[model samples]
Target chain A: MREKIIEKILESGMEFVSGEELSKQLGVSRAAIWKHIKALREEGYNIESVNRKGYRLAERPSDLLASNNICHELDTDIIGKKVISFETIDSTNDYAKQIATNENEGTTIVSEEQTSGRGRLGRHWHSKSHEGIWMSIILKPNIVPYKAPFITLIAGASIAKALNTLGVNTKIKWPNDVIVNGKKICGILTELSAEIERINYVVLGIGINVKTMEFSSEIENIATSLYKEGYNLSRVDVVKAIIKEFETLYFDYIHKNSKLETLKVCRNYSAIIGKKIYILQGEDRELVKCIDINEDGNLIVEKDNGSIKEIVSGEVSIRGEKGYV
Target chain B: MREKIIEKILESGMEFVSGEELSKQLGVSRAAIWKHIKALREEGYNIESVNRKGYRLAERPSDLLASNNICHELDTDIIGKKVISFETIDSTNDYAKQIATNENEGTTIVSEEQTSGRGRLGRHWHSKSHEGIWMSIILKPNIVPYKAPFITLIAGASIAKALNTLGVNTKIKWPNDVIVNGKKICGILTELSAEIERINYVVLGIGINVKTMEFSSEIENIATSLYKEGYNLSRVDVVKAIIKEFETLYFDYIHKNSKLETLKVCRNYSAIIGKKIYILQGEDRELVKCIDINEDGNLIVEKDNGSIKEIVSGEVSIRGEKGYV
Candidate 1:
């Protein structure tokens, strides 16, 4: 009844609706309708007063997190049916992996705080409350185990397109992170389970600092959040964009006569091109000039010995030749 | 006191140590020593005795498992220094992965049975209770993440040599399993946690059926155990050989400079050599011939159109021309 009451208000463009009509339509007391309107206001939805006429919806908050205000606003039906929220955890990645085995495909998990959230190469990712998006999406693709790495590339491109849709120009760093102004804004950690011939599921963990107030001194130079870049973009908007892009990329990669056109998107958005960098090959990090990403998505690096070393996605660390990142 | 009793018995060359001396040396009652001797006998230790004389060792049942019997007989000062025993578990590989994080290096986990024992690709490995040597070794090797795959090859060669020491002629099935008479006798599952430049730890799980009994009909055609192969072997002996060989291989691959030499061992031992196999490349399964393994330990499979595909260590299932496993 409360949902219908709000839906009617939203459908009416926040115009005044009689309290008696709301009560009669919802089969509830007028006082109950007033209480729900107050709750909606607390969720950052402005419910205007019109005395005896009714309540009018005025405005929504700038940041749309997974609160009651945003869940009702979602347009898609399947991807995020049950939105689970957490206050704090050791890792969103670890928690997502724990429940991935039994959950249905498209189940979504979000955490407000992560104590030991991590990125690739065992690096810590700062996830403060409401300042970042710590989330994982469960996907069970009917693919083989060997085809798993390509999904990482797809995830990177999906995030890149999502940011692009939001009018935020960002570059992809090969396999999974998104960089803006040469600093990392988002990280995609793709973990999967599979048999030799069939994949059971894949949990794509995406962590982004939407309203970055600060970063630890160690990473202050390398990490940049959306808020730090002069944006208080609603988390809800980012989530919707990400889901929409993932749906398109996943369909293209899995169903079409596919070379995974998403791979081309990644190469197009790659930020490592034409840069002098160090390719951490073994214990001895080799200096290499960035050339191009080969067709199979290997980062082709030309070394000093006139030898070209192509690096596929593993624990690769890209850095400027002289300065530390 | 029982351990001391067994030690004395072993050192005395199967001669019966007097019950009084055994009690005095072990600081136990004569009756207590007699109780232990009886327990040892129940565990398949052949004890020789006379009136008022303590037990003397004759022979041990070669079960090829880790137990107080042979763990007490081990000669190493480092590897297998500590052992944890489980009757059954989901997967020895899973259990071993936990052990690597729990204990220090050189720890060995032995399971008398693995109810849900698994090989690579989560395939069910038939580990009948007390019929097989199912265990995992935890090691903190000083190696990089890229070099981590080589550990699989090292453990494979070591197990093949260990089975040879027990007079079982087993061949290495490249990438993982050990085969006898064209059937899998043992399989090695190697998992690692690492940074780009350093490995945190590695858990190597080796599952082999000591007695060929209790194998299911489904696995009968493709699997063989030691006892059915007519080898009077003990699980403890196989564990010792594997641990000894692993330490040697770990030293060479980590301490010495032969990562290429170690990787070459994979091509030599794998079943893919001179065979046509299906390489699962993303969405399409390609029919390719195994030409050679490149220096990076990736399989160089030549596709029909003159292009070559480098198959990384993923879900690789080798098959003949027929559309079957």
Candidate 2:
């Protein structure tokens, strides 16, 4: 009922809707409408009310991540059909896995803060309160377990393309990280529950630093945020753009079995291609030159001995010659 | 404590141990020893109680699956360190997955019957009561997620080699099934919980039809049991052999990063090499000749156009030209 009222107020478009008129249109009592308006204001919605003018929606909370604001004009089929937002959570990926078996495909879980946020390889992710977008999407692709690594590439392509469209030029660091000006701005952590022949569910977790201005000393040299990089974009716009772009690329690859667009975006906007990078595996590190991303989404690299090798995701971490990219 | 009593009784070698001696050796009261003896008897252990000779292990129930029977003289360092047996359960894999995070690396779960057993690709597996070895082993290998599909091959090699050593003459059906006389005698289902970089745990479920005299008509032509093939081996011996063999191969792969022994067994005792097979994917089927098993454990096949291709496991099902192999 609150969503419906918010939708109506949004549809009003700066025009005042009287209490009696709203009650008649929405089939609710005048007292009930007033109560809902009070609740919406308490939730950070700005509403102006006059004696005779009734109420007008002045502004939506820019920092708030509500379904009414994020999904207002979002265009997607299955990616964000249902939005679940939280002020605080342990980890979006963990919560997604708990409900993945029963949740619908593309049901998204988002939070403003994470107490125990995680990154790839069980690394700790710093997600301060209302500083970034910490979200997870539950996907049930009807592909084999071996085909799942490519989906991480699809997610990287989506994030890179989405940020580029929003005028924040970014590059994907091969498999799962998105970078801007040779520093990390976004990361993707994909987890899977699968059998020998098929995948049960894939929880694609994405963490993007948008409004953070300061970083810890350990990651200050490599980590960055949109606000710190002088791009003052709203979190709502970034989330909406990513969800929309992801749906397009994800649907194309899953339904058509075509990797043309994702591969194109990954190749054109890759941060590591044609660069000298170090591949770190356990205690061993080898410097290799990246050639290209193959059609199967594996990284093709030329070794120091002039030998060519295809590197699959999930086993090794890549780094720039000087520092983390 | 009960396992200790069983071990003591078995060590007595058909000689009766007096109640006072047992109480003194095990540091328990006579009445406590008697209570444990009664509990063991209820669990299908046959104990002979004479007037002066207090207790003797007369016989071990052949149909019973218990930790004492399965782990007695089991020569393995990590595979079967802990054995959990159930008379009836929904599925061993499901139960193993529930405790995989907190459980040790080599914890094994076995059941005499599975009410809701599962096969690959969401298929139903019928596990009759007291007739088969329905078991799942939880492993925490430090390998990446892409390398997990080969573990199924390792399991298949172990089963085939173990049965061959017992004079059963079983052949592996490439990735995950064991065949005898052109029919499937055992099937393996490996499930994984993994991140993009590393695997969390793998539940390796193996179901071997040992003493089933009958199968449903739907699978009668395709599936067969050991007793149906005129080998009346005890399930205990079969389970022990497979576990011992699996421990050897599993440790070799996880510790040494060697697939040499597993690949050798798979190629030596393969059922599909040098034969015409049908690759089934959805509603499409293609007849291809099985050329060889590659170094990566992939199936090298010659298509109809004489083009050779490498077929990875987990996406397609292979069948004999006539029927299931």
Best by DockQ: 2
lDDT of 2: 0.89
Residue pairs that clash (backbone atoms under 3 angstroms), model 1 = B62-B233, B62-B234, B63-B234, B63-B235, B64-B234, B64-B235, B64-B236, B65-B235, B65-B236, B174-B270
Of the candidates shown, which would achieve the greatest lDDT relative to the real structure? Answer: 2
Report the number of clashing residue pairs per model. 10, 0
Candidate 1 docking DockQ: 0.14
Query: DockQ of all candidates, in order?
Result: 0.14, 0.68
Give each prediction's root-mean-square deviation over alpha carbons.
Answer: 6.2, 3.8
Model 2 misplacement above 4 A: A1-43, A48-57, A303-307, B1-42, B51-56, B303-307
Candidate 1 lDDT score at position A242: 81
Q: In candidate 2, what are the lDDT values of residues B220-316, reduced to their tens digit?
A: 9989999899888878888889999998988889999998999999999989999999998879999999999998999999999999989888767
- CAPRI band for model 2: medium
